[model samples]
Target: MKQTPERILLPVSPVFIAVSLFVAFLLNLQPWGHWVGVPDFVALVLVFWGIHQPRRVGIGIAFCMGLLMDVNDATLLGENALAYTLLSYFAITLHRRVLWFPLKKQVWYILFLLLSSQLVQMLVQFIISQRTSSWFYLLDSCIGALLWPVVTAILLAPQRRSVNTDLDSSL
Candidate 1:
């Protein structure tokens, strides 16, 4: 009797992509702070996916995802795209280090990544729209940073279980 291992799909499959996009749309559409803001849920999901499945999701997808967000939010074209692309690229570069770190450490790194992405987006908005930056610009990053742990916990739970199982089998 041949016992084959169950085929587990990559966590970041098309379904995840669609759900992420939908969440992004909701963030853009949701009436939050008098329609002035909402958390960048898509960015959060993308960061998780990037760290978890860097081999499948890459810079191009990140850029396109940002562009879609821009179009949906009616922001200057390429602003979100640039931010997302840069974030994704950096995440990919640091993926190995992030994976090795403990959850708390990874949350800190992801917070930085989220802030960096927002900084890039803010810079673009300032340059293109010549809009005055407000303190409120930092709010999304703060919320995202706070949510980082929760998001990471949810995303990594299954993987951790699988990894533990593998370790047990090897031992």
Candidate 2:
């Protein structure tokens, strides 16, 4: 028989969530080039928080973050906001169910979510620009999904519960 060590989760604070989002936003600022199809860390963070802390991080936060992303990218304003809001709605809607799955499986679902948001974004850009876009833009969704495990491990690290195994005798 195999023994799996049991662990508990510690309560998380809102500040931690805020700081992580801010850091993700900063990471999003890095210029990954228009051709690399680099993942959007901000989107990844928003989805993670949307799934894990919906009450604290809702569509409003996602919208605000998306707006910031819009300003940062210098693209059509509200493009990212719309897409991110849609993503937030989907993530929040399925958050409870998604929570039940293990991290590996969650990646597949998150990938779908990421792809949907990217599709929305691509549509918006297509409508505004009215030009055929290179398929590389969709690469961000795949990249984001690929990086989901790393993001999960980093975010959940702080919440891991440890059993000291030594009982305290203090009354």
Candidate 3:
């Protein structure tokens, strides 16, 4: 009989999560020039963590991150917080189903969640500014949705582990 190798899921450090959030914040702060349609990297990370580590990164954390985003971007105080909170809610609710599927399938879900977040932010902006946005404003969600697979793969790389052949024999 042939034995199949098992991979272990190592625990991610809290420091790693903090640093990832900070890096995403920096990414969100980049000057995209006319590319205001750039993906919301911070929101993407929030949604990802909400799905994969719901307990550790719940709505509170999402809201806090959103606040940071709002402050950094000089938008209304609760704008990003509301969007992130909503996104986190959806991500947590769908997490179980997401984990059961392959990453390819999860991409669709990620897109949906991201779009929803963008919608919330847009609504908040319209309410506050009392101005209608351009149809082109929706481009950010599309761009973000398209980036789901790449983002997921990058974030998941550290969690993926193959058995170390020499170390496996000692167990």
Best by TM-score: 2
Model 1 C-alpha lDDT per residue in residues 65-113, reported as the tens digit of each score: 8888888778888888999998898888888999776666787788789
What is the RMSD of candidate 1? 7.2
* CA deviation > 4 Å runs, candidate 3: 1-7, 166-171
**TM-score on alpha carbons, each prediction:** 0.77, 0.90, 0.86
Each prediction's total of clashing residue pairs, residues at least 3 apart in sequence or on different chains, is 0, 0, 0
Which scores better on TM-score, 1 or 3? 3
| Model 2 lDDT tens row, 1-171 | 555644677877888999999999888887653445788888899999999888889999999999999999998999999989999999999999998877778988899999999888888887988865677878888988989999988998898875564567443
Candidate 3 or 2, higher TM-score: 2
Give the candidates in order of TM-score, highest first.
2, 3, 1
RMSD, each candidate, Å? Answer: 7.2, 2.5, 3.6
lDDT of 3: 0.81
The 10-residue segment with the lowest total lDDT in model 1:
156-165
Local lDDT at 154 for model 1 = 67
Candidate 3 lDDT tens digits, 1-171: 554444566677678788888888888888872275888888888878888788888999888999888888888888889999999999999999987766667878887898888788778888888867787777777787778778777877787776554875866
Residue 130 in model 3: lDDT: 81
lDDT of 3 at 143: 81
Backbone clashes in model 1: 0
How high is the CA lDDT of each candidate model?
0.75, 0.87, 0.81
